[model samples]
Target: MADEVRQHMLECEARTWLRNGYNTPERIQELTLMIANRRGQVSAERLIEEMRRQWRRRSEWLN
Candidate 1:
């Protein structure tokens, strides 16, 4: 449960970064590495997925 909440928070942070123009691939990779170091590879992967989902949603909303 706690881990789920932490992952949710990480997803939210990733979404915010995407909304704020930190959508570069290099920046995303950097964030993934940081999360992997602090959390784990799985968490980092989750963050990447969340960022991708948010980016897709934003693109859809815009177009």
Candidate 2:
């Protein structure tokens, strides 16, 4: 369940980036590569941290 939530959040964030023109296909490919390369070195904690960071940024902008 948690993993599903995380994935949905990831997709949401990616869509937000793409819709706002902050993401290009090449950039997405690079980010995909980064994730692919972090198979063993990265943790779920770090991924959640990034999601929190994005939420913080959005919240700040809404202020």
Candidate 3:
């Protein structure tokens, strides 16, 4: 479905952003707002939080 594809693309974009050290609060907030505008506030909040948690875990493992 189109929605599924969009969600996947958003996830990929978020991952790329985080991987590239764009995980700062300002960047996350900007991304959250962008996604929320396109999707919904609840979904955007949940997705960003999940991505942040995953990124943190990876960072911990690396360090």
Candidate 4:
């Protein structure tokens, strides 16, 4: 159940990156490391919240 939700959140994050043109190689690497480090420990809700906060802060730099 948790894994399923995590997979769905990952898919959504991928789509958001695609739509926003925000998935640079560096960002991908960061996300890869982040996921690898957090996998099976963090809840999907907490992960998504942190990702959203990061994105919000990052959008300023992106703009």
The lDDT per prediction is 0.79, 0.54, 0.75, 0.57
Q: Lowest lDDT 10-mer window, candidate 1?
A: 54-63
**How much is the lDDT of residue 22 in candidate 4?**
41
Q: How many residue pairs clash in each candidate at the backbone level?
A: 0, 0, 0, 0
TM-score of each: 0.67, 0.38, 0.60, 0.37
Worst 10 residues of 4 by lDDT: 40-49
Look at candidate 1 and give me any clashing residue pairs: none
Give the Å error, residue 1, model 4.
0.6
lDDT of 4 by residue, 1-34 (tens): 9999966776567556545554566765565566
Model 1 Cα lDDT, one tens digit per residue, 1-63:
999998778767877778766689888888888889999999788878888887877765443
Model 4 residue runs over 4 Å out of place are 23-63
Per-residue C-alpha lDDT of model 3 across residues 1-63, encoded as one tens digit per residue: 998997777666667667767687998888889889998999788778767766866655444
Q: Which candidate is the best by lDDT?
A: 1
Clashing pairs in 3: none
The CA lDDT at 35 in model 1 is 85
Q: Cα miss at 5, model 3 (Å)? A: 12
| Tens digits of lDDT, candidate 2, 1-63 | 999998777656644654454444565555556655775335433543454456556654433
Candidate 2, 52: how far from true, in Å?
A: 21
Give the C-alpha lDDT of model 1. Answer: 0.79
- Superior candidate under lDDT, 2 versus 4: 4
Worst 10 residues of 2 by lDDT: 40-49
